[model samples]
Target: MTDIADLPFAMYDAFTDVPYSGSQAAIVLNAGQLSTENRMRIARQIGVPATSFVDRIEGTTVSLQFFSTVMELPMCGHGTLCLITRLVDLDLLPCDSDDWHNATLDLPKGKATVKYRRNTNGRIEVMLDVATATFAPAALDMDRLATLLGITPDDYSSSLPAEVASADFIHLCLPLRDLDAMNRLQPDFAGLAAFCIENGLETVAAFSTDVIAVDRHLHVRDFCPAVGVSESAAAGTTNAALAAYLFRNNLVKPEGADLFEIRAEQGLKLGRPSQITSRIMVSDGDITRLQVGGIATRVIEGKLSLPSPDSGPLSQQ
Candidate 1:
């Protein structure tokens, strides 16, 4: 009989400085021996917004898989951020060394890049290279949005207009007017979930570029209960999609500038306020890179013995 091994895991609050705030992600390092079912079982056990399983392949490069307690995802931005930051926090990488500031992620879909750096203020920030933020026209059901999110058409207007934006999966970009409307949101979960199915969408991001808080270029919220994520406190991909939405419309940068940064905030209503910064690299009129990063702190660590092979087939909780 094969021995069931013990799997160790750690949880980190990503995109925020405060503990128990931000969107928490669980990480399982060196999980090469585990099966997909085992990873899914482990993710369900942790009960975080998302859980990542990492299999080390070489120095600064690892194969990663993300789960939402329901199913596996090709990639997850916050989960990736937590893994990169945890590597630094655990001193698994020479985070302070110039040569050790970068890492490559091998996801189910493809390879992604990440860089770690400390600002002049001595705060550590992890930057992801998602080069995949892109946009295409989206056919939106405005009435369904209003019925589910309680946002009247006049409550907000999108400068960039609605579209399917992607850093990972396609997210419907719904630009609102300001933070007040976001804070007042009480999304109808059942209705929203149905909308996602009927429309073949997993998530919709509603945001306001008009800053309600000083220095925050955007205030946003992402809903994805269709894929089992009711809400995400701070999402790396969602913010990247927002930046792409803004950039395509010529919103943030000067006429000829290439590099740009956007300050953003989310999760205020849940009280787990998260701050994220998105980096944009435009080679011409086209954006060549989409990266989002922020501070993440470790909160919990534990180990669990895997289910016995003799046990019945596993199912998500």
Candidate 2:
């Protein structure tokens, strides 16, 4: 019989400084030797929308694999943020507390950069620089989208139009008139899932400029039913896409000549309030790069026992 191994894992609520709020993700340490099947099983057992498997930590570079409850994903934004926070909190990275430290993430989709440092409040701040997304007008019917979200056509924002944005994933961006419209959203999950799959979309991001916090630029709610997540408390990639959409449509003005920073709030409806900071770098007249980052709070730490190879079918718990 093969000996079972125990893996250490930590759960974190990403995109919030509070302990229990924000989106939750699990980071499995020393998961390099685990097989793909084992990784999938582990993710399911963690019971989170997304889990990060640490493949290797080499110098200032970390290789990671992300798996959702259902299947593997190219990359996970909140998961990456949580992993970076955990690494810095554990003192695993080589860095000085006062200065910003740069790290590279080797993901299944591609390589990205991360900058982190211990802030004045003694909390770690992680900034993830990801690929700049491209936008295309969605061909889907507006009336159908309104019905799918259980909202009326009048609730849609005329100023900010709908578009399909793609970064690491594809998102259907829906602009609503106000926070009341955002609050009234009651999506048909099964129908939304089918709609996403047929439309080659991943998530539906409904957003409004009216925010709860005076400092926040936008408020968003992301629904990812196709990936088995009915709604995400906080989604970095989806927010990044929203940021790009705002810039592309000239909705937000740059703070400086070449940089624009957006404070986005999410998850109030779910009560797991999250804050995401998205930074956009513009060159000449076009947006060049996008970065999403946030503070994460560690919630749980435990060990997971690896299942034996010869074990029968595992529980779907």
lDDT of 2 by residue, 1-317 (tens): 64566778899999998988999999998888777887898788788989999988999899989999988988788998899988877778865766888999998778889998888988888888877788898899789878999999999998878999988999988899999999999999999999999999999999999988999999999999999789999999999999988888888888887999988999999999999989999888787878998889999998877755455433112
Stretches of candidate 2 off by over 4 Å are 1-3, 308-317
lDDT (tens digit, per residue) of candidate 1 on 143-243: 76877997776665745577887656768888876667766678998899888888877788888876657888888888988877888899888888888
**Candidate 2 overall lDDT versus native:** 0.89
| TM-scores for all predictions | 0.90, 0.95
Worst 10 residues of 1 by lDDT: 308-317
Which clashing pairs does model 1 show? none
Clash-forming residue pairs, model 2: none
Q: Once model 2 is optimally superposed onto the true structure by TM-score, how far is the C-alpha of residue 239 displaced, in angstroms?
A: 0.7
Error of 2 at 39 (Å): 0.9
- How does model 1 fare in lDDT? 0.79
Q: Superposing all C-alpha atoms, what RMSD in Å does each candidate have to the true structure?
A: 3.0, 2.4
